[model samples]
Each structure stands twice: as C-alpha cells, then as structure tokens.
Target: MVAEHSPLRVGIAGHIHLAPGSERPIADALRVELDRISDRPVHGVTCLAAGTDQIFARVVLATGGTYEVILPALDYRDTIVEPSRADFDELLARATRVIHTGYRHSDTAAYLAANRELLSRADRLVAVWDGIPGCHAASTDRTVDEARQRGIPTTVLWPAEARRADRRP
Candidate 1:
C-alpha cells in the first residue's frame, strides 16, 4: 500500500467527443496506466467537460481517490455543462472541491485556462489522446505538449485501435 502522506494527483486531458465503441476501452486503459504510473490511486483534477474528463473522474473515484473540478469559464454550467453527458452533474456535485476561474467565456480561452490550472496543480497528467491534434485550441495534443514542457510525468492512454476513424468533433 502506498503511504498515506503521498497521494498521487492526476490531471486529465483528452478529446471531448469520444468515438462510439471506444469509451470503455479507453477508460480501462487510462486506469491501468494510472496504476502503473503510481503506487496509489489518484486524485483527479478535472474540468468535467464531457467525454474524457468525466471518464477519468469516474476511474479515480472507483479507485478510492477523490476529484476536484476547475471551471474555466463563467456560467460554465449554463453554457457548456448542459450539453455534456448525463453523468456530468452528479460527478461535478460529488467533486471534493470546485474552483471557478474568473475568466469569462469568450472563445476557447476558458478551456485553455482550465487546462493550465489542471497542469499546474497536478503531479501527473493523464491524457486520453488519439495521437492527433484536435481542432480546438485546448486540444489534447496541446495539453500533452504543455505537460511535457512542465516536466510533469504523464501517462498517455491511447490504444492502437482507440484512434478515432474521423475527427468530426
């Protein structure tokens, strides 16, 4: 068992829209990778966006770790959270802490700011990327690059077949 004093802080970054038939495998892969990277279950820092962020939070909770959310934009729930997956609210509510970044929503700036917060606070980054750069500014590729530059140990969970056939989202 890992020492109680040393908890692993894991921040998640990945595609918001996951390809059909890919979510379970990706989550399993992420959990396995996180386990391999650290001796203990991890505390997840999530923005609770939709696909990837929510999955990481679930895995962290399943493994006996807590999670915290950082909202990048103002009125995030009113704008972005509504369209997210169904479990988003329950997960958000269950988060150990919630921080709303004062950055108002205007373009992708909010997400970018939240992503930065995730990286800065966590000891490790868990990226569920498809090895492709997403269209948005807060893409998984960009997150990976930032983590690398920050010298944060990262565990990227992208199975060979998990790559999306198309990047429509």
Candidate 2:
C-alpha cells in the first residue's frame, strides 16, 4: 500500500568512484530504502557523473521511476570522463529534465554551487560515501554534510568495510 507520501522526489549524490565493482549492492540498498521511506515508488535526480551518480540514476530508472539530471557544467567535456562520455550522452537523452548549472569550467566553486542548486529542489537526499573526515576527504561527504546543515533528511550509504574502501587505491 502506498503511503500518504508515497512516490517521493529523492535527490541523489555520492562519490564519483565508490567500491569499484560493487555498485549493485549500493543501488539495491538505495532502492529498498527509497521504498521504505516513501512507502511507495520513488523518483530521483542525479548529476550523472561516472560512478555513483550514474549508478543511482540507472537504479531509479530501472525501478520504473523518473531520473532527472542536473549537470554540473554546461557540456559533457567538463564533467564526464572519455570512456563514459557516450553513456552519459544516452543517459541525458533519457532524463525527464536536464538542467545546466551554467558553469562552463570545472572549478570547485562551480561544483559546490551546482550541488546546492540540485539540493535546493530535493525533499530528501540519498548519498553513497566512504566515511572519512576533513573537507578534502570526499565530495559526497562534504555535500551530505551541507545537506544536513540545511535540515534536509539525508540517507548516507557507507560501505560496510573495515576501512574506507571507496577511496582510490
């Protein structure tokens, strides 16, 4: 039975690379959590970055929900890696809406501003991050903290490992 707040508009953010080959587990968990929270289906927004963002968007789409994208920059070259460029192109085509953050360069200020823009439109935030400390630790962690400070309900999925395995080796 769908709850009164079923079908939530979730906002997703995470590290670009999280658990190299274990994206499925995190995606599955997100699916379950979203269902639990909304008591129904859930749609989400993603930045469509190579790792976590793309994976989350795919999961949302697979679950018969819409995936909206807020690109960090104006063009693909600024945010997408070479090998993943084609995939991003296709994903963009499938998005319910595509928002350009109006920044052409890949600067930290632009990225954070874009993150804020995306978070502003979301009711809840779903984040997949490696538990780490410090500002330069992870963008996902930083963004999640920002969301929390703004009183947005955030669900953070950290890999259940002995250490922060999400970090690049």
Candidate 3:
C-alpha cells in the first residue's frame, strides 16, 4: 500500500487489442480523471500487456506519475506475444515494484488469479474497454464488477460513441 500522503493508486484494466483510433483518447481521459481525484498525484499499476495496458502505462509515465507492474506469471517475457514483449520489458524496467503472480506460462487460471490480485490492491479501477459481452476481455469486466462489489469506484473509458459529442470534429 502506498503512503497516505501519496497520490491515489489506480489500477488500469482493458482489452489487449491495439485499435489505434480509440487508444490515445482513452489514455488521455484516464489521465484526466486520475488527476481530478488525487490531491498529491495519481499513480498507476498495470500488467503492461499490449493495447490498453501499454497505453495507460505510457500515459502515466509521460505525466510524471509512478507505475507498478504485477506480472501474470513468473516469466512474463516468455508468455506475452512477440510484438508486445518489448513494451512489457520496458515497463518492467520502469515499475516501482514488479510482483510475479507465481503462475506458470500456460495457465489461464493463473492469469485470472493474477488479475484478481492486482484488483485487490487498487484504490480505484480505470478500465478502457468496449462494452462487449462474452469477450476475451471478460476478465477486465469481471475485475471491474468485483471492484464495484467490494465498494471500490470504477471508471470505464470506451465505446467512443457515447463521448463522441465531446470530440473535435
């Protein structure tokens, strides 16, 4: 847990697809929302996967905030896909803490368990995702729901249409 004087600690969740159009806007929105909630400054934690996770981490770092990484498995380098491996490595280097969830590379159960562990520690959750049912990103959805159930606040950033009116044409 972070010190009380430290900024709010936020956990970021989202799908792993890199659909370029939505990524930048979502990252910007998350940073803005986080800035609004913290008197000190906001810190972000992520698994540093491709797509939403990488984008969130990058934005947090860019905004002079701290980032922590909770890896899904002991050897995350071997588990993540190739293109994303470099980003993950970079995040690991920058993280304040890198906790390995003690799972093997091939276990889906371990990954979900790791996700739960990450969610358990956060003061709030910021999710960037499409509101799609039965998606592979269901873990993110589940994490947000579980956080809400535990009375932690959740902010979701996605389904761009709802926020389209605010965008510059």
Best-matching candidate per lDDT = 1
- Give candidate 3's whole-model lDDT: 0.75
Estimate candidate 2's alpha-carbon lDDT, on a 0 to 1 scale.
Answer: 0.74
Per-residue lDDT for 115-169 in model 2, tens only?
A: 8877887888998776654455228778888889998899988656312234545
Query: Please, what is the whole-model Cα lDDT of each candidate in the order they appear?
Result: 0.82, 0.74, 0.75
Model 1: what TM-score?
A: 0.88
| Deviation in Å, model 1, residue 54 alpha carbon | 0.6
Which tens-of-lDDT digit does each residue in 1-169 have in candidate 3? 4578876778888877655476667777877877776765567878887778888888888778887887887766787787889888888799988878888773667668767877887889888766654344336778788778988889887755322222235
Mark the regions of model 3 whose C-alpha exceeds 4 Å error after superposition. 1-4, 136-138, 159-169
Comparing 1 with 3 on lDDT, the higher-scoring candidate is 1
Over all chains combined, what TM-score does candidate 3 have? 0.84
- Every model's Cα RMSD, please? 2.7, 3.4, 5.2
Please give the RMSD of candidate 3 to the true structure. 5.2
